[model samples]
Target: MAKDILHMTYENSLTFAQDLDRDDPLRHFRNKFHIPQLNDKDVIYFTGNSLGLQPKNTRVYIEEELEGWATLGVDGHFHSQKRPWFYYHKFSKEALAKIVGAKPSEVVSMNNLTVNLHLMMVSFYRPTSSRFKIMIEAGAFPSDQYAVESQIKFHGYNYEDALIEISPREGEYHLRTEDILSKIEENKDSLALVLFGGVQYYTGQLFDIGSITAAGHWAGAIVGFDLAHAAGNVPLNLHNDQVDFAAWCSYKYLNSGPGGVSGIFVHEKHGDAELPRFAGWWGHNESERFKMKKGFIPMSGADGWQLSNVNILSSAAHLAALEIYDEAGMEALRQKSIRLTGFMEYLLNGFNLGDDVLKIITPTDPAARGCQLSLLVSKNGKAIFEHLTRSGVVADWREPDVIRVAPVPLYNTFEDVYNFCEILKKVIF
Candidate 1:
């Protein structure tokens, strides 16, 4: 059945992608990635929200570093490759800054997700007598809750007092900006920081970041975001929005490979703020770093937040991915994403699969979301998920019930979504 579907010369299948690709300014980018092959067929890959498909150039990028290590030995730190190991992270800084709408000086690619979150919290989660509460979405990613809880304990405050959760109203799948703002206003005197995921990992809701930051500031609290599911998935103007800080992993939407190095952003306004942070040798002034100085004189910008030297291998993958992003600019990619995802919604509704079978939990408005859609299965969610996997429809499932299907604009086509919907109808009915 899967074979026949793939072989089917349906006009909708070819015409949809052909029409979009014909006018698609970013259509050529599909060739840059290595889509997975299964049984001589290109598997329908709709899991970029969980893990992105690797870029073909990633191998060449890694090979260059390997050859440099073999030839230059220690000297590879300063020579032997297109980008030196010593300054490899710098290769992608400008591109990353543009992706996140930050200044080059305000962004640095470094450690993985949770590690960077802890580091940012150390400096930002300062709890005093009266104002020490931290506000976050109730359904935040599990790791985020753990980090926030641990930070509160480190400050000798009970979690109950230090943590404020903004949850959706009863029986609702998404949160409202008005509700979040109201919570900040209600607890203005006690709120210390407003920290949230720029896009909720489970619900696929893109929070109103700029408005959230303004609300936090009005209440005399700092603002930050965990961009793990947001960066590369959406257009984030971090610098222009004046967010105090943000951190995101490159593995998922960024397509840097699983468990890849993450990036951090600090607004230029706080570049010289008198905030106490945990420091280490790598953050020392570059000019005097090798001198083995006595005290840690941190660099002035986001690089100062680094606690150790960059991990060359992991950073190399990120650099490879960023090159692809640069070639196919974000604005162009986002334009395709809207059309592709809108088509997914259209097809799902076209199925006319009774409401008792499947329901979409993600927000309907395009402005409130990204490429991913969270489908709430009415029954046998796990079984259906396994069935989809067996059928070569690659998606991810959350606990209890919810299947996430993300059609990444960079490598996915409208035909993929069209075929996925056809399979779903057959399986459900």
Candidate 2:
């Protein structure tokens, strides 16, 4: 199926996009989402990178918990018929594990993304006098930058000296794998942690996680990833890659509602190891949690990092979304994604827009990106973005100039991609 989609030819026309949609095995999945309407027509939603469209079952999922709360009261914690609120976090584990390529024991659904990142760092970022520096991609999402910097400061080190941000070469939009490895080698001794976004939010570039993790490990540094943009948008093998740890939010490609519960992965190798972490009752060994003991006997695996009990309502929504993923399968979704985004790129390149007016900062190679394409609009950038908004195209605009658009495979169709480019072309011309 993947090979067939990869080798298929594309044309610049509405009929072609429609035909592809007609044959798309996942096409019916679109109806499962609540696509925003504009004058009774579905808006071209390309901001799945920022916020995923709501799953139609999201309300049903949340309502079940609400109903359980009303009737069961406090007893719902242990007695809810469908899903016991006490073990709510465990409900999504199997599905999430499949999405990220990990054993259920190595992954857990818990706090928000940043909070989980800090928690992971607390355990993984054990900076020593000689090995105190951390490495990250330059121009990473602001929250990641702040988190890494704060961790450095918390360790009594200045970010300027202790943070090593790897930037792309002049005139290049993405980092070369060789450059990343060389940078790690050069600073092997002082590097304490090698952290990076699995897929860069700005440029839509998917880093070589396995290679990076191997390099970081070889350099005697702990390796991790902020998979906010990579989690469900692309295929991942976190467990096999031997990634020390990873954390990602569900609000993006995972289709969980806003501020949805985040997920964490701890390689089985360190799952039971004693590590520095902020603990709470939820993370304590379940068998003895009610004993109210002073000692923190953490539950094994990623659950040990939990700081609090799961938020029932939000997690219900998360589980609702994960159900869809489990049925669709990540491998199938990835194959469709490659074809969908490749078609988008093929159409965009057809515009032959001058470099002065617009530039696609995202890598052209399908292997290096997910569904998003970041356009660097040099002239009238904001005006162009506004025009897209007025035309009902939901895309994200980053700082002084880039526009990010994602043709999410689960719901967004090839026709949506073609229409978006058509809308973009009108404003440019």
Candidate 3:
């Protein structure tokens, strides 16, 4: 599917990419985001997988909340002219559900990414003495590694014994699907939970969520994902996949701002009162929320996972970004995303640098990756990254030796990819 749409011989010329940009369906969205400027020109920003470009309307959305606060004060909780603070998170629910392909009843917005991971762990990481292992990818984002380790330790188990780190085979960059499935089968006896990043932060590999979830259930284990880098960047089917739970930050692909509010999904099957969870007033039944409740009765569905009242300011920023997503639609952006990332891969693969000069560590199969491509530039990685930075290419530099570039579908264009490759070519020399 990716090849048929984007594997044509892409010419390495400024005009070639500009021509593609002219025909791009989502090109107009580029102007909607505030691209960073260098020397009065917009820098070729390509780090949407980290912090996304802020939407132009973010200020207006935030100001609306601020204005409500100023004009209504305590009354803003219910009397705001626009959306009241009492239900601010609700504005983002539909959009997030659409983005992740979940029912509105199964989604809610709150907290930050790792915090939600911890909270979800508190509820779902039920490890008995007989079955107390957790499986995670070897190169998961450091925060997830820390969270999983701590969760194991908190349960009075040693990390080394309770954690199962899955890695790529020798002489391989990405983990094979068969290898992962086989490992799950081998350790099904002791594996109680499978927690992995929906998209590996370092290698940009998109794990097979549906297959992995089915495998975990078949093996009598619960499966969940931390989707910090995947939520808005790729198509998801959380509800249909029958995932036990999932959490993700909005700062990256959701364009909500630094430390933007996080969200989570809990399958409807777990909404029963019997499932033990870490409870808070916000998770209480809304009708009795102000009653200063004696016994904790959680709201049904994912709303039962909320820890506190929504952050009005951050959620306003999220609402602003989600409006754009609602208008753009995930299906349309996904089609463009496959094309944009495919074009970047096409150019990266086309780079004729010798093996030692550089190599891409991300999977070539588009189905197994997102918009990011991690370049393992041998020896001079930091030097090359600095050069790209000086040349007005905004990207992320991972420690050791990798440069991560993501040409976001909302704002980035083929010309951005072309310009980035041009600078990279010069840097390599």
lDDT of every predicted structure (CA atoms): 0.87, 0.93, 0.90
Estimated TM-score for each candidate: 0.95, 0.98, 0.98
Q: Estimate candidate 1's RMSD in Å.
A: 4.7
- Of 1 and 3, the candidate ahead on lDDT is 3
Q: Residue 232 of model 2: what lDDT?
A: 97
* Stretches > 4 Å off in candidate 3: 1-3, 6-9
Residue 269 Cα positional deviation in candidate 2, in Å, after optimal superposition? 0.6
1-429: candidate 3 lDDT, tens digit per residue? 455564556776789889989988889999899989999999999999999999999999999888888888999999897898898777788899999989998999999988999999999999999999999999788889999999999999999999999999998888888888889999989999999899999999999999999999888999999999999999999999999999999999999999999999998888654677889999989999999959999899889888799889999999999999999998788878878887777777777776687888988877898899999988789999999999899999998999999989999999899888878987786
Better of 1 and 2 by lDDT: 2
Candidate order by lDDT, decreasing, is 2, 3, 1
In model 2, the clashing pairs are none
Q: Residue 167 of candidate 3: its Cα lDDT?
A: 93
- Which whole-number lDDT from 0 to 100 does residue 1 have in model 1? 14
